[model samples]
Target: MSQRKRGPFVSVQLMSRWRNIVGLNVGMGEFLHKYPHVFELFVHPLRRNLCCKITQRMRDLIDEEEKIVKEYEPELLQKVKKLLMMSKNGTLHVHALRLIRRELGLPEDFRDSILRTHSKDFRLVDLEIVELVDRNESLAKAEVEKWREKEYVDKWLSEFETSYAFPINFPTGFKIEGGYREKLKSWQRLPYLKPYESKEVLRVCTCGGIERFEKRAVGIIHELLSLTVEKMLEVDRLAHFRKDFAIEINVCELLLKHPGIFYICTKGSTQTVFLREAYSKGCLALPNPIYVVRRKMLDLILLGHRNTRSLEDLEEIKEERNGSVFRTNVGGRRDGDWIVPILDSYDQNAFGSLGDINDSKQPFDGCESGRN
Candidate 1:
C-alpha cells in the first residue's frame, strides 16, 4: 500500500491474481474484508470494480514511520558505516545490505539516499559493492565490549573471564546438565579475537582450538544483531553475508548451540535469531525510534476491526467534503454481492508484476528450546 503512488490502495482484481503467492486459500477480497480496520474496501469511482485500500489509520501509521526513519537517517548511516568497517574487506554487497535493510532501519532507497549523499563516508566501488571510505577508530569497538567492561568493573571479575564473556540469558525452562555451568564458564573465559579486530592470526591459529573460533563467530553474529534496531534478524538473511563476514560455521546450528546468548524462533516459516539479552519478555529492552514506530503499527494491527468505522460513514464523510450525495452501496453488503469500483487513475503498469508478498502473522510465542 505504501508503494502505490496514486493512493494507499490497490485494485482487488490486480491483487486477486497474486493471492496464491500470499498463501491465501480464500478469495483475496474475502481475506482483505476480514480485517476492516487494516484494509478499507471501496468501489473505485470510475472502474466499478472491487478494490481495497489500507485504512486511513494504517496510512497515518505508515507516514509516521517514514518520518521517524527519515529523522534517524544519520544514525542509520552510522550503522551501515560500522557494518562496512566490520566486514573482512571493508566492503559489503548492496544485495546483502538490502536483505537486512529493514532490520537495520535503513531506508528503501539507501543506496542513493544514504551512500550517494554521504560520499565522504561511503564509496561505491562498483555497481554491486559498497566500500567504507574511512574506518573510524572509535566505531571499531564492539558492542559486547561495553557489557564486558561493566561486568569487569561492577562484578570485580577477572579480565580473562570478563574480556570474552557474553551476557547469557538462557530461556526460562532451559535445562542445565551436571558440570554444564563449569564448562560454560570455562568456555566463556577463553579469549577470542574481537569481531572488529583483524582475523588474520585467529584464522591461522589452532592453539586456542575450534571453541575459540566458534566463539569469535558467535561474537560476529552478536555484534551484527546488536547493530540492528530490534536486535534480531532472520537467520536466512544473515546467512547471505556469511562469505562477506567470514562466518564459516553453520549459522543455524551455531545459534542453536548457544541458546543462552541467542534465541532462535521458529514460530513462523523463517528462522529468526534474537540476541537474548537485548529482549525482555518478548519485547526490546531498549526500543529505538524506528522500533517504537513499528510497534505502533503492530498495535494498530492488533486492534483488528474493533474501532473501524463502516464504509457508509466514510461515504458520508466524503460526501460532506465534496458537497454531493452519490448513490453507492458502500455498506452492509454481503460478501461477493456488491460491485466495488477500482480507481481508473491507478496505473496498472506501475507494478510490472505482482511479487510475492508475505503477510504471515506469527505472534510472539516466547522463548522455546532450540532442540524443540
Candidate 2:
C-alpha cells in the first residue's frame, strides 16, 4: 500500500480556533484537519458528478456563484485551480470544476478573434480585455495629440491672420455710422513728410542751435505719422524728433487751424541756425510761414496768462504749447491779438525771393554762420 503524508498535529480546540480565525465553519476545519487524505480520495468523483451533463438551473447557479466570487474573492478561481493540483476538498474541487466548464463553454473563437482584431499589442493578451482597450485608447490619444501639434505650428507661422481688425458700431440716435477705426487706418496710410532725400538735403535751424538734415529724421516723422510705425519705433525716436524739431511739422498743420499767437523774425541767425540743425538731423524744417505760425501758437499756449480772451492769456497758451517764449500777433486785430508779425520789411523781401529755396548763406546780412 502507498503511504500518505502525515496530517498536521492540530487538536480539535486548535482546529476550532483556526476555523474562527480563517472564518470557516468550525466542523469543516476540524474535519479537514483530521482527514487530510479525503481530498485525494473523494474530490475527483465529486467533480465528475457535479459538472458532467449539468442542468440549466445548475448552470445558472454556478454562473451566479462565479459572479459573487469574482466580486468578493477574485483570486479564488485562480487559487482553487492551483490548489487542485496539490490537494482538494469536494466543495473547492466542485467550485473549480464548474469554473473550468464555464470558461471552456465561452465562445473561444469569438474571444480570440476580438482580441486579435482589436489588440494594439499581442503580448497583452494575458491581461484583461479592458486593459487592452485602455492601451489602444492611449495610442489613439497619442495620434490625436500629434495631429494637434502639427496644426498648431502650421497655424502659428501663417500670415493670413496677421492683419489688424476693428469693428463698427452704431450708437443710439446716430445714423450714417461707420468705423472711424478704418478711417484712422486710412489716414495712417497717407504718406508723411519724407526727408529732403524726397528732394536734396535742406538746411534746418533752431533759434538756439543748428544741424544738417538727414533721411533718418524724416524716417522718424514717417514713423510718428502712423500707429503701426509708432509701435515698431522706439521712444528714443520721439526724443530725437523733439531734439531736432521743437514744433513737429506734421502736428504744426493741425495747430494752424486754431490761432491767437505771435511770430518773431525768423531770418538772420535764426534761419541759419534752423537750417544747420535740419541738415545735421537729416529732417526738413517746415516752411518759414508755418514755422512762425506754430512758434507763436506754442508760446501763447505755454506762457501767456490763463484768461480765454486776453493778450497775456494768448501768450501764456503759446508758451505752454511750444515750450518757447516766442509770441506773435500776426493775425489782424479782428482775429485774436495773439498773432504778431515777426518778419520785418527786409525779412519779407528775402523770403519772397527765396521762396522754396535752399541757400546756406545767411540771407539777411549775406553772412555765413558757417556749418555749425
For TM-score, the strongest prediction is 1
Q: Could you tell me the lDDT of residue 170 within candidate 1?
A: 46
* Model 2: CA > 4 A from native: 1-272, 275-296, 299-372
**Which pairs clash inside model 1?**
43-341, 44-341, 49-340, 49-341
* Model 2: how far residue 255 lies from native, Å: 28
RMSD of each: 13.2, 43.7
Instruction: Write the residue-wise lDDT of candidate 2 on 1-372 in tens digits.
Output: 111232222334344556656666446434443322121112223223211122232234445544443353323322222222111111122322232332222222323432344344222223321121212211122111232354346546222221211111111122222674344334323332222121122222222132112223333333232212001122223233343232234323221211111011123323111112111111112122223333333333333232323232333223323422233442322113333222111122122110112223221123322221
Among all windows of ten consecutive residues in candidate 1, which has the lowest summed lDDT?
348-357
- Give the alpha-carbon lDDT of every model: 0.70, 0.26
TM-score for each of the candidates: 0.81, 0.15
